[model samples]
Target: MNTPLPLNQIGQFDDEADVVILGYGIAGACAALEARGAGGDVLVVERASGGGGASALSSGIFYIGAGTEVQKAAGYDDTPDNMYRSMIASMGPDQAELIRPYCDGNVEHFRWLEAQGIPFERSYYPEKTVFLMTTHGLMWSGNEKVWPFRDAATPAPRGHQVAMEGDTSGAAAMFALLARCDEAGVRASFDSIAQSLIVDGEGRVCGVTVRQFGQERHYRARRGVIVATGGFGRNEQMLARYFPGLPDTAEPMGIPHTDGSGITMAVAAGGDVRGMDGLIATASIYPPPQLVKGIIVNRLGKRFVAEDAYHGRTASFIMEQPDQRAFLIVDSEIFAYPEIIGANHSLVDGYESIEAMESGLELPPGSLADTLAVYNQQAAQGRDPLFEKHTDWLKPLTDGPWAAFDISFNRSTYYYITLGGLRIGPDARVRRADGGVVAGLYAAGACTAHLSPDGKSYASGMSLGPGSFFGRVAGREAMRGSAAS
Candidate 1:
């Protein structure tokens, strides 16, 4: 094993940082904050002009499996074991052991978030039961929807929004954290890209080679480098190479910066990757019907799952299909009930205006009848070829003005960040194929394959829970160890 070299011993030590965090999004900012709180000097770098990777672009629903107090009150006998089993059953057991500890600590992390002045609310339906303990929604600018789940098994109204109605959680979370960081005196620069890991002769990461505004610069870490850089969902080359069936043509409705920078950095350093081919593909209306409500159909113009299904089941059903595309089938009732625009009358129309700027792919700008005609033709045959949909949901397009978008690859409107990336152990450290830690580094948040090795969410809202739990743990652990000398 090689020892990690100090930045001074290598090419040059730009600045001595106790913890150098790449990517200024939630995970990156959280890691920096924790490290700084633990007495480590920190530096944050972002490739974008502002922070908001996927976190900024999200629906802002914090995924928590079970609320702490609620689970205790319910007679369901919830435990970390229960949460782990649920997650494994929902996603896959491949990464279960790694994620269990984090799930166990989820509520504590949320409390941490609350302590940081990030306001959250209990389940809107307080009397009901949910999958996790309690449902909490974030109260930030622009979020207007009430929580969606019921107080049953998974509980309703646990999802939180940044008070900003529609899809503003991404920016809200970023700005909130940015303000906190600025108050904490952590240094950060936007539009700075991390080119590669700065490893020394001993093979441990000492820092990074970064480029900003046509200038190359090196930043050194005295303790460690944390790669909170987002995933590769937008990189067609990487997606095609990893995700076998996913189409790359659909534009990402979320952040534009998630080009798998962290995955690349880790893989280049001999880290192993997994769970890329699987996706938590969502069923959404492409350029969603403006004046009409709709159901997701394949090229055949048929409904697959319930048109009003929640996130997990919706994505799971879509992934089960062969073609991976869904259509928005509408009826006269849909047109009349424009109020159907909201999912459960809570979510505002976030995709309402994208059609004008993103024509050919979005709705309103595209033809509903023409799109449906082509799909209806394909459904008539024994096979649905356009998107290769093999599900039994196929039916004739009897509805008038029915529209369809070829949401294959990249055409779908509501694409969530799949939790699949560099596989890590329970300690939140990246592992080589040989099952040993790749020293001088750590990771957190949705970037790693730690959550959904099976390529799906264990349950709805589990993503944020794990992000906070593991992010806090990894941050603390990384600060505890000395850099390999």
Candidate 2:
């Protein structure tokens, strides 16, 4: 509520701590560990039976830059300023203050994770794929190398993946963080859901109401309460309300319990929200990186975005097309059976001539042909003058047998995540819509909007990046809140 919860009306606290963290995802775990390390009595209330909320499902990569050991071992030169310049356009000016510190402190963050026993390999994946299926440690997880960003800043591979065998390194990372939490003696209540924020007469958060087991319990915090519950991806109502452009066909990614419950609780406590309309919707057309050589045209048969753009960025434009329909036209040389099963890149048809394929797909007679005429002409010369697709992927569609894949969201599928939540300062303190701080309340992870304001702005590991980084920030800051009883 905009108004504060009166202390006299509140019931007796069933438990107490110096700081209480809601949810035990990467951010929550980090917050608990950091607070405990500072000697604050910490309690982590988790909705699941175990830790690692959505972070457990991630590729377990951190969007790190500024000359990490992995980057050095990969023989790439990077600097914090270069990384900052690369991210400014995406993060926008308001969040620009965030990039500098994150870039400068990135190497230290890597060392921090290393201290947690989460190993990181020094190998580099120099391919243009999404997540490495192999154990390679570094890859391009964002738009640093693409147009717009590249013009602003020199590119470097910043995606530092945890040393795990496969793409699902999130489990490995969370397991390690959870162990660190245990070692630090952070009290974690599993299967406990945070129902609401407990505030004092002046609207300062001091505890939380939790539903654990079969009972409703109150856990008081002498210093502060931090909400680290992940995003609202599982919440249908919130999605429909905030992201009106997101089609229902787009599947929500994350745990089933990522239902905006914590966000709603914080909002009810008067926490302001940001990026409510920001979304990360992706129809992955990579993995078969050869397919990126193709061109994606909308319903009117015009190339929308650069073929070499991040798949999520490409998909954002695709979903905005007429009827959310688009086609990926690839020559036989580049065609591969789509690796991502959920993207549903079904074949529309193959054609010997561009005219026949255009007519068959019901496009305006000359639409597809005209689009390809320019694409093929530029591509043959190792150039994409229009979209600036990297020269490395520049290949003419001169192959006889050409095909089109119907990668339309109206017909196929897209993996989506909500990127909007409680608005917070750089310190992870919840700020009201009127710009006043929600006293003693801090939040991190998906529940609090930071980086990744939209699909075009998203990077692969950005979700966990903000989650883990700010989780510690929230922890460190919460320890400074008024320790009044």
Candidate 3:
């Protein structure tokens, strides 16, 4: 965590640009492109040897709509109002104001992504799966079809993936973004780490101090400095300070560069942080959507959540358990759907009967049996009285050869990323504790708390969706500030 210094204390700049961006991930690259597109000279400094941060390691899914062209071609009717309602319901009302612009401009955002060479197929995946195994461009990334939220907003498939085979869409998406930056003549410096921001006498951010080639140098930003350095998933110190409830054994799922440097730098400059406790823990239990037909039990063998809920919500519930543990109970009839399984998951134990399986798991007497009896009774009638799981996934688990899959956070079966960072306005300008903007300072991506306000309701693609979209907003606004100046 580098400490920011006052402008008067820093020496003359070694380089200068209209907009200086830190971390050349998808967010930073998008910011650079938009800043350049806004007629501002752009400079991108990446800590890695090349572009692509965790964005390259992601599944490359973007949650966007308002009846995107691809969604329309796929015979899905969507509207901004419906998308807005869904986002409010899915991400929580706390995020409604920040997400309103995103929902309203989603169609244009989709078009912008396509214009940047990001491709999407005119197809839809109609399945209750974790990720799109096919080249389908559209699917439900969140629990849109589930109860409560389903009735609150018209459900639509908003998970738009890049049209490419295999899981390389993340890398492919980063490559396309970098290409756009190149075409825009954005100067990129790899292996350059931004340490801290430089602020002018008026308290406006004016430049950045970076370490490159074993030397610390200062670069002036005529307009502003954008911090897109991702989250603090790998920063143990930040996690302990902000997210004390996170289990010690919980492993971060992103690249090592997500060490919360951007958030730290912003904070050092008096930026207020939000949603610091929000963490995106996930148990991606699909390669076989049929596995969702199973039941999830806590240590007491009690059902905690709807088995078919979004994986993030399930993981969050599991983490809140006594020992941060949970198990997915299945039966011999559980057959893997080849097309739906995104990754292979091994079963922990298998037994010839429910009693035998319960004994093998060492659960209390009748705890497993009674829970199963009620669940099986409701499931047999295509109903879930407890969790209200959809009928499509309501099936009895009475068959022999029962199995359990460990979905515990301590068991290395779950991956996580911190979803909290500096608070920012809709224009992506970093805000201070006094409810005022930090002049000339902006942030986006995982480093800013714009989307995913709560981990319990986290949706897939929410990170990259706001990361990229707000990155564009930050860049454009930075350029506008420069023009106004």
Residue range 69-94, candidate 1, lDDT tens digits: 43343323345554554455545567
Candidate 3 structure, TM-score to reference: 0.95
Clashes of each: 44, 2, 1
From the highest lDDT down, the ranking of the candidates is 2, 3, 1
Find the candidate with the highest lDDT and give its number.
Answer: 2
Clashing pairs in 2: 1-268, 1-269
- What TM-score do all the candidates reach, one by one? 0.71, 0.97, 0.95
Per-residue lDDT of 1-485 in model 3, one digit per residue for the tens?
46777888886788989999998888898899999998999999898998999998888898888889988987878898998887777677776767889888889988998899988888888877666646788888887877767887878888898877766577778989898888889998789989999988888888899999999889889999999999898888888887777755566887998898998898988899998888877657764688888888988889988888888887788878878767788877884432322222346677877778778777777788899999999899988878899898998998877888777767744568888888999999999999899998999999988577766677788877888999999999999885313
Model 2: lDDT equals 0.85
Please report, in order, the local distance difference test score of every candidate based on alpha carbons.
0.56, 0.85, 0.83
Model 1 spans > 4 angstroms off: 1-9, 69-81, 123-158, 162-164, 285-309, 319-416, 454-462
* Global lDDT of model 3: 0.83
Comparing 1 and 2 by TM-score, which wins?
A: 2
Ranking by TM-score: 2, 3, 1
